[model samples]
Target chain A: MALSIAGAGRNALTEKAAWFSESLARGLKVARAFDRDQPKMRISEVAAKTGMTRASARRYLLTLKSLGYVGSENEWFYPLPRILELGYAFVSSARLEEFVEPILQRLSEATDAAAHFAVFDNNETLCLGSVFSQKLFGFFISIGARQPAYAGSMGKVLLAGLSDTKLEEYLASVRRVAHTKETVTSAAILRREITEVREQGYALNRGEMTPGIVGVAVPVRNKDGTVASVVNANWISTSSIKAAEIKRCLGPLREAAKQIEMRLASGAVPTGWVSRER
Target chain B: MALSIAGAGRNALTEKAAWFSESLARGLKVARAFDRDQPKMRISEVAAKTGMTRASARRYLLTLKSLGYVGSENEWFYPLPRILELGYAFVSSARLEEFVEPILQRLSEATDAAAHFAVFDNNETLCLGSVFSQKLFGFFISIGARQPAYAGSMGKVLLAGLSDTKLEEYLASVRRVAHTKETVTSAAILRREITEVREQGYALNRGEMTPGIVGVAVPVRNKDGTVASVVNANWISTSSIKAAEIKRCLGPLREAAKQIEMRLASGAVPTGWVSRER
Candidate 1:
């Protein structure tokens, strides 16, 4: 059956494009609007966040609930674990374990630190995969965890990968939170840090986001030489011992990133799974 | 801005519902249709698998591409990393780490085995969280990994949690593949095994799914007294040493399950994150 959205009044991108489904786009927005800060939200909360009418948000939430992707109790609505099927669909389809998992595991083992591989998502860096070394503090890396662009080594490396225009746009749009006393919330300072990350081909953070954890990250590049993902190894250290730890982890982190880059360049990863845009 | 589907035919459940967005439902189906086996699919393939016409599939895929959730290479369409946001939204909203992560970590450390917490999803058991002990085998449990209901201790415990009628229907419908010679593929045998699991309050498997691994699992129950999730600990063992390992792990698995059950019952976890259905 043919579907039409003649006057749905969506964004110009979908409005101008033929065969676009505004309903689908809006539904996904509603699904994503419920995050850690607002796990269970009302229709009005969703509408306010997603810029959809309350009626539109209600329809999408109810539809998702019926599909088992969402659940509701009284006026509160929240996502179900079944919603993970969507992410797993990508993780499984990408078969990231075959390439990224082993590398992270090996890196973690070698450096005695937690290792992670992450990609840029929205304005944050999202961990697509991670391996917890457990040798340091009980710092368990949660998959799908996010860190702001100005806070972590991996985040700065990811921000460095963006084009100047995009990076500027991101810095202008993002609200920089002071996660720790060391967090750089100034856009000008973050821009300088990202610039240094680009030149050095690595980024280092000394408890900027989370205290006592020092991280060293290097970018994994695609065949086109653009950053596809960032691989990092982090350790728990005192201020006095931080420099030696960073120095110790940097070589292995860079080596692992190069291995991952070579794998991507060798055409082992699916084309669709690689970072195609900033 | 009222939209009506007066003539568009869908399943009776959705057809009878008010304020249900069919476009949204169909769009999610198209997204989930790309899994490990069919990472990248042609329009015709997606159409046939999702039971939509080629034109409809094309529209959904294109719309998803525009939204950065799906990517296309020539005639093939595949999901993007952005799709993980949908799953992460649920994961972040659920905040499962507060109860499940530390418990799994402790269980793994105590048993010296890899530990995982999984829930029933469709016909398979989906691992929602896990911890690697790095002691027994280098067997890393990937989150979002799925196992057949008849194959693993965790899967069997989940299957046993089903009502008799639902269990019967599931056994009838599932394609039971023999992952190993020891795997029970016979429906009658599986039914008997599930019955024993229901009686025993736990399940054990000796190399059924992976020939070298022995696993024991116990169900974590919801406030309603139904199984919410299954906690498992597994070790690499030969057939000769399997029974001892299973016995060793069973106690900790049960204890961990109890802790998780208490956490769930105490309303410590968000209500929307709990298993409201089998």
Candidate 2:
């Protein structure tokens, strides 16, 4: 079958060369045209946004529609819920949520603050799961949102887990643009902060990612003791819940992380990580 | 760009033809391969399940990965949280959740029963949004899951909204396989039930889909008075909440559905409908 041929050929060095060909690149950009701010677009709008011809935009949009990732009505185009299957499949199969959701829910109930689980994706940290607290004015971390690895509590926790050489390389790739006055913009400052996070077994960010958002995070370790992920609790700065208050919740947080680690160690895969070659 | 080929040199007929081509068919299967039961799969698993070669799966996976829908590490694949962007983009842009979520949340809070918002996807009803009740042991409904349009409360509500001819066509397509003893199997019986639902402006499913699970649902109309969707509240028989108790919550549900209609009328586009023409 063409599928086997494609699969066997993927590992070949020559296949990598063909993989990045213009057609695939164009196809990707077409898919990227859909985002939170602009979920629906007309054919002309798609063409303008994607910098492709109207004819081309229509083709890609129709192709995507046929693929069930894109949907349309009249002349306006929009994405579909089935598109989530792609991502949900990755996360659910790994049992990441099964391992972590209960923990986060329990932590939220205990700490009365929003709890989040995040993992590193390239140079940024992406929220994988979150359980919002009952408080009216608390952390509102949207799942799938990204934050730089040097400023937010979740980011720092994930950064602290990275190998030193990889960390250095990442730091060099992107400028430490300050998100707020409290954000550490210097590489030296962030490096030191990450090192301290590794030493203290936790990370704290006070209004760095967003004003009034303060969070404390602890690393979730694998059986090998490598930091596999980070879990955090977020609260508002006005709640009198300073870093110390966040620290107070660390016991339960650590316990939850340990529980998740045990589950993952028991052969439950982490969410979003699918074993392909095996 | 090659994207232009999707729509170029094609009239409406050819465009429709392109919608069902082998490439698009394979892509749809790949997308469908991710579901609640199997959220993530290895390349070989995807290949096996979708009848594609591992190479074909890799290409599609890599293509999706580059588009930020899929993420990979060490040859292990997983879905990214950003993939929710697709589902959210569809739901949010359609403005269905803006009105529906608050209402569902309120209903769940009021009755302490699980509430869900669903819409017709061809012959099936797909969950667009959901809110679990504060009470324990309520029915569980996950976003993006699909159910037969002839069985569940939400499904009946949507079916009641369909044009008579379309409804008849759909009824004829199913084998009326009983999921539970209470499930309606005869076309004559189902047609009668649907007529009653249309007349009463609501639908009820008493242990039709899952034994001991009872649900009540109402149709949500769009600005044009077309049945745009349905909202349902479900409870277990053990809860002692009879179908009447569920029906009492319809006032709030209808109010929320109206709000959703208003939002959609104000310019929210439905996100899941595929265009007949490319």
Q: What does the lDDT read for residue A168 in candidate 2?
A: 87
Candidate 1's docking class is: medium
Q: Candidate 2 lDDT, tens digit per residue, B46-100?
A: 8998888887777777766665666666755666555554444454454543445
Q: Which tens-of-lDDT digit does each residue in B1-278 have in candidate 1?
A: 12334334455556546788889999999999998789999999999999999999998999899888988888888888888888888778777655588888779878998889998877788888887776754566677777887898898998899888888888778898888888999999888999999998889877898888878899988877888889998878775345667677777888898898887878765675544444
Residue A43 alpha-carbon offset, candidate 2, angstroms = 4.3
Task: Please tell me which predicted candidate would have the highest DockQ against the true structure.
Answer: 1
CA lDDT for candidate 2 = 0.69
